[model samples]
Target: MGPRNMAQGSSQKPEFFVNPEFITTKTRAIADRKRENTPVPRFTALVPRGHTVPVLNKNTLVESPDGSYRDGPSTHGTDRFERRRADIVAAAIPVLNDQGFKGMRLTAVAELIGLRATGVTYYFPRKEELAVACIESGFAVLDGLVAEAEREPDAGARITQLIALFTARDAAVRQGEAVPLASFSAIRSLEGEHRDRAVEGYKAMFRRVRALLESPELAAMDQTDRTIRAIILLEQLFWAASWLCDFDIEDYPRLAARMADIVLNGVAPGAIADPIPSLTAPARPLASRDESKESFLKAATRQINEHGYRGASVDRISASLNLTKGAFYHHNEAKDDLVAACFRRSFTIMRETQIEARALAAPEACRLAATVEALIRFQLGPEGPLLRTSVLSSMPVEHKTEILGHSYRISRQFASMVVDAITDGSARAVDPMVAGAMVHAAINIAADARPLAMAQAPDIVARFVRPIFAGFLAA
Candidate 1:
């Protein structure tokens, strides 16, 4: 089936897979620790130590020279405390983007706001609580955009408005006009109440976009296809916050409009483009045990990509490769170690393909186009698996931090290529960082775009890259 058809039609939208739930007894134990005032083990990546706890209830209302209060919470006292928390969250936004949920540190956030870590921690007792606040603040901004988009009388205009809103809001956040919030991508790293809130925000956004995509004008499109397209569009928009700072501040509206156009019509210079090619069959088998190990990795990647890390089991992955659990254990000591290996493999493949593209003797645009095509083909090929970093969240805290460092390095490499392209005049002048992020986002979302497989890789790459770069309409 095509990527479009991969979306299973149902009255309910599918829930994204989360990390495996803790054992009932273990969960209870943790709750018991909380009640007993004993320190429970927390993910080091999610919560760093060494912050001084704030003294309770210092409600002084001294006035500062800048007309701000010296001491007070936002609602009760003088609103100074609330403003301080807001400032810390803002500083933490870029850190969250750079370090991700698992890697972000309260010390880093405190440094950003020129406050001691203890001062910041006084307001937020736990890192999870702070992260939750940031994530929710971001959603509030996004929800406002969606609400405004809903005001459009024509359903056709809704999508474009949303795209523009996302782009502009991202710009506003970067400029410090608005508070910083974690992108929806951070949702994977959250658990418990934080995860629940983030999930609700995502579901609401999905429903609105899905409804807009199902308009009469899009009647020719299947409902499932529409759902998939909406997801693709949202991914592109949500990732905007990462790169918007790299571009000229004034270009947001135009860039947003271009993005909307590309999402809706696609970047075919003239006539409508043909569909991209799809994967046909699995890779050929080998006899050696070494080959078996490789096979297990590939199958494991695919299984994880299809069903989240929690859902994909050793039995299922091994079964797909016609191997026993013994064979699986032969290749790896444990699932956590195996998954970390899988992530390394995925990053290595992508980095290698990108390096090869750069070595090609061609114009920068052509080189970029080649790299994009190669990556997509690899992602859809028998050996190709989508780069789902959600795997990082399921691993040990130490592993999560290590993998995140590697991912950031890869992203910088991508940004470097974009900078080279813009400087060489092979691509339009935009924020290279933003452009690079958009490319990564596209590749990530395309994994589920099974429909693209029906077309050739070059054509598919062109269709996908065109919307982001050349845009759909000609000047």
Candidate 2:
């Protein structure tokens, strides 16, 4: 009447088996019971693999978005059953495409796939697995890009190649903002460290941009810190190009140039007389193939920076010379390739401008001030807003975060310029790094300062973009 025992020789009932007859007296009931317990699959232990986020697990998973296991009995799971979940993904992909990570819902996917919620649940007993698949697909897309970038000649060329590999206009057209949009969505869905990882990867994109900008002719800084400064400047430009949404997308080139100047040249020292002019692009005679290439790059920069990546089509690039896609491809491989080329050319112009500005500064303070003016010019200029929308919005969050790392260096460069000015009787001597960081921070705050005042926005944005920078440098 108490604890039931099941031994070969004894007559007892196995626990959970209501019928004592099932506990055969002819077998070793203890050994059987122990074996059964050994194989008892713990339902509570069925943590889904793709259970990355509630967003991915609950929303994106089609088959078993809510499926969780139970260790109680063999009431489910078919070894032969592959759990296709195609119906889930088929319907899910469109929603995911449109709304990104947030749109994936198992019930919705089930409704679209013509499966009952339970029917869908039967295959996936857990929503996590389905999310894992979705995540896998995302990674597959990323891997494809990494593989394509391998064909690049050097780090500089590799960035162009890598960017082209993923950010091509054709890719955007084919997928309707495929990689960029999806990644942007995924980043929004991911939480915490996972989000951070995405951010770091995106920043690497800028790292490549910096490498291209810091090429032989433009790179005058032999010091590691200066090189780091250049990298930071490129990062800021890369981010401003990729994600600044409040403004027109075309200004990316101007933005890049000014940012480059700030990092490479530092601020100019002269007193304030007038707002710097939004100078017209100089006329250049592109004659030889080399010149033609340069011109193409320059023109391409102007176009993409003005129009977002999607807006700037292959035809647009070729149309400048009445050329076709074939002709464009003859010069560049793909639209993304062209983007990389455009970025490089933009950096080239910016570098040249920065070098000139550095030379023109009458005092060291003037030089430092020049650096600040150059940065502001691009953002306030016509090209700034356009480039902000077009090129910058296309990059993923991971890429944007990486760009910020480079921007840190630019802040130091600004400070260094101030130091130089003060040393040579140009301006007062002070903490160069701190002063530069303040100005650089102001520029960054303004870069994405729309829809809300960076000075008085939501907590995260406000805390992140505190605009006390100008005051920091005020003499």
TM-score of every prediction relative to native: 0.53, 0.33
lDDT of 2 by residue, 1-475 (tens): 1011122222221111111111111221221222221221211111112110101111111222222211122233442232234224333444444434433566655665456667657754544344334443343343333334433444344333433333232222222222121323344344455455544544443343334433454344233322233333333423432333323334323333333333333343233333332222212221242776775675665455433455456787788768978888887867766566454444333344345556763665554445444544443333341123224334445444443344444545666666776688664434454446545544433333232232232232222211122210112
Please identify model 1 stretches exceeding 4 Å from their true place.
Answer: 1-78, 114-118, 174-176, 219-222, 240-246, 269-384, 389-440, 448-475
lDDT of 1 by residue, 1-475 (tens): 0001112222231111111121111121111121121222222221112111111111222223332222232335445565455555556666665566667788877765556789878977787767666665554445445554655545557777777656654554444333344555566556787677656756665776676655555566555455545666777775665455556877776677656655554332221122222222222222242665666677887777655565478897888888899988887898877777777777766676677667766556556566666666666655666557644544567678878777767777767886776677665555555556666776767665553444344445444455444442211
Q: How many backbone clashes does candidate 2 have?
A: 57
Q: Which runs in model 2 stand beyond 4 Å of their true positions? A: 1-270, 273-291, 319-323, 371-412, 422-475
Per lDDT, the best of the predicted structures is: 1
**lDDT computed for candidate 1:** 0.55
Where is model 1 poorest over a 10-residue stretch in terms of lDDT? 47-56
**lDDT score for candidate 2 against the true structure:** 0.38
